[model samples]
Target: MTFSIVARDGDAFGVAVASRFLAVGSVVPNARIGVGAVATQAFARVSLRHELLDALAGGESVETALEQALAADPLREQRQVGLVGCHGARSSTGADCMDWAGGLAGESGDVAYAIQGNILTGPEVVRAMEEAWLTSAGQPLPRRLLGALLAGDAAGGDRRGRQSAALYAVCPGAGYDECGVLADLRVDDHPQAARELARLVELSELYFGGPEDVESLRGDLAEEVQELLDHVGVQGDSVAEALTAWAGEVNLETRLTPAGIDRRVLEELRRTAGR
Candidate 1:
């Protein structure tokens, strides 16, 4: 009833999952910056997420952590899990899991990934995901992960159909307010959960994403940008103050830069002011 991948891209770790079950995100995905990521499903042992992450943080290999996690569980044959860490990637599909269940793991350079699914349409589903992930080199981690999920969906996702989907990624001190999370977006219940999840990811990028490559504001440019903020009803005594207020209003405080405003933020201010 579920499919998931846990992967490492550079110093970041990410997980993407889809399932016929409701609220799969709450149970399937977990990640920590500088540690690793894990997905537990198909009679998921939710506790394994914490245990596996703990093991990885303590310098255990992905394979070792997985073995320990399974050894500690009496109902191992009913649980499915995939893990990726600095050491590598590993996954397991319990024998007692529903038909059409399996997992795969692979690594290239510093990037490692694992794909697993149970009650899926066929092995082709996971294979397509692996192919997509491998082919998406040089792209952002979230986009590559989402591409894999979409490929699984195209190959025939959860034979039971879609009800929920989630995307999670983490980097050191990359979360909101510098909390160490990168992206955590979910479509808890959607007919086309993967597609909806993609949309939510875009919105998340706008509000929570980091600054992009664009020109910064200063001196005269800063004053002109401030004039736009004032035109948009953002009140402040100075340009920096006004832009900061506007950024807070639009939930884009994270994208503001001390050197000047982020290009995306400036564009948004223009758009909102025009409206």
Candidate 2:
């Protein structure tokens, strides 16, 4: 009843899932850096989420964690599993008795993914998903993930149907400070939920910032920011004050913390660059 991809991008990693079932995220996805990402679906087992995540975190590779988990389950044939780990290791399994269940694994640089599902059209779903992942060059990871999900859907996903969808990820920068989810959201039953969720993620990245996005804006800082602000129309004290308020409310100060000036400085810059 679900199709999902567990992937790692550079220093960031995430799991995206779409299903014709309710609360798929609760059972179908498990992920961590030191460990791996695991998705257990079909009949679905809640315990496997934490158990697999914990086992992966303990330093087990994707294959080992999945083997141990499936080994303990007597009803393994009625299930589907996928996993990916820190060293870019990946593995997937689909029982012959699992009614159309199948999966695929890919390894490329710091990026890797395990795509799988039950009630899916064999490798077609995985192929489409992988194609989207490979073709989405120069795009953000979140966009690539959504593109993969949409490709799977187009190729025939969850033979039973479509309903809820979700996205998840982890970043070390989030530990520093951020007022947002780690890209976790659920579209319980919207027909266009996956697309909608992708749009939300893009919007969030615009107003706030993402972990993978920090580095490009960090170097030779002050001049570049002034140029960007000047280009965006932040002239005059009154307008700059508004910009300052906007930045503060969104906690963007972390990017400009090196400026070391009073809020008035931003306000003046805004006034100078008035639209």
Candidate 3:
């Protein structure tokens, strides 16, 4: 009834999941900035998600962390889990999990990633997920993880149908506030959860993205923004102040750069100002 991908991209780690269950994000996926990521589904032992990350944070390898976590759970046989740590990746499908249940992963390597599912339409689900993950090498970490989840969904994920999905990840100093939170988005309940998850990922990138395209507020750029603000009916004494006020109105203040604006913001202003 669930499929997920857990992966480590450089110093970042994340989980992307979709399931027939309601609010799967609140339970199935877990990750921390400095540790690793874990997805526990099947019977879905939520505690194991934390346990696995805790063990990894305590310096255990992905293999040992998974082994110990499941060993401590009485219903481990009913559980399915995928984990990725600093050194390796591990996946487990319990002997008693429903048919078409299993995982794909490499226990030790530079690429720490795992794909797993249970009650899936067929092995094709995980196969498609693994293929997407392996082939999406140059993309951003969060998008790469979501790519795999979307592939699983496209290949007939969770034979039971979809209700919820999530994309959670962390990296050291990548967040808007420089706090390492890359993304934490979820479709708690949606008919097309995986696709919805993808949409949320795109929105996250727009709102929480960095200042790569921001230009210094001077010369032609400043003049362009002043004209745009006037065209958009945004009023202020200074162009930057007016733009910041407009950004606040549109809930885009997080996208503000140092005395400048993101190019995407300029694009939006242009769209509205008809420039």
Candidate 4:
């Protein structure tokens, strides 16, 4: 049906997907934090997703982890799977299909990945996947994973045609944080879903505010900080509340400067203005 791997190397998370049919997103995406890997495919094993995450979170190796899991299922051969950890160790499995099938597993400097697909020759798909993975450079893990999938697609992917795609990555931080977003994008149907997903991911990087956003924190009338306070409607005895609200709007670093606006200062200004 579809094949791909979700993996992490330390703080970086990655996802890769490809298929002959349209809309491969649901069957071909996988990811975990402290865990190893997860594989969801035709006759997709939904439980395996969480189970793999549980095993990884418990500090199980990709090998021992998947072993105990597959042991519980007799139809393991008909399934495809792969897992890698921050240490670069890995494991993979593929089964005989009515049609052609193929896959590969490998390690690389604290990072590893597995790739598999059906309705295609095994070596050709794996070869294209490996080559694409090696040639990609300086990009994030998501990009690298997508590159691998694209290579397989070019080499004759699922044999059904193309449709949907997806991407996911995890890192530390809350949802509102710029650096947050462990699992990112999903494009369920389209001719170029992978490319579209990559574009959105890049656009997100552009608009997401971070420490550098301090440069945009200036107030109007050369008193942008004051504008922030006024916008928040803090005056007189309410100056403390206003300053608190303003601090939330502008960077605390710029607001707390020696020339920074603070609660006491806002109160003084409020009294002078007789507001």
Tell me, by TM-score, which candidate is best.
Answer: 3
Task: Give the lowest summed-lDDT range of ten residues in model 1.
Answer: 212-221
Question: Alpha-carbon error at 154 in model 3, in Å?
Answer: 0.7
Q: After superposition, how far is residue 262 of candidate 2 from its true place, in Å?
A: 20
Candidate 1 lDDT, 1-275, residue by residue in tens: 89998899998899999999999999999998889999999999888899999999998888888998898788999989999998789989999999789999998788999999999999999999999999999987888899999999989989999999999999887869877777898889999999999998888778888777545677777777877977887788778888888888889988877776787887788788784
Question: Any idea what lDDT model 3 has?
Answer: 0.88
In TM-score terms, candidate 3 sits at: 0.92
Residues 1-275 of candidate 3: C-alpha lDDT, one tens digit per residue = 89999998888889999999999999899988878889989888878877888888899888888888888888999889999888888889999999889999863354579899999999999999999998898788999999999999999999989999999999998877787889999899899999988888988887788755888889998998998899889999888889989988976777887758798888878987887
Which residues of candidate 3, in runs, are more than 4 Å off?
107-110, 215-221
Ordered list by lDDT, greatest first: 1, 3, 2, 4
For model 4, the superposed segments whose C-alpha errors exceed 4 Å read: 20-23, 88-91, 174-179, 209-275
Candidate scoring better on TM-score of 2 and 4: 2
Best by lDDT: 1
Note the Cα lDDT for every prediction shown. Answer: 0.89, 0.67, 0.88, 0.59
Model 3 residue 235 distance off true place after TM-score fit, in angstroms: 3.1
Ranking by TM-score: 3, 1, 2, 4
Q: Quote model 4's TM-score.
A: 0.68
TM-score of 1: 0.91
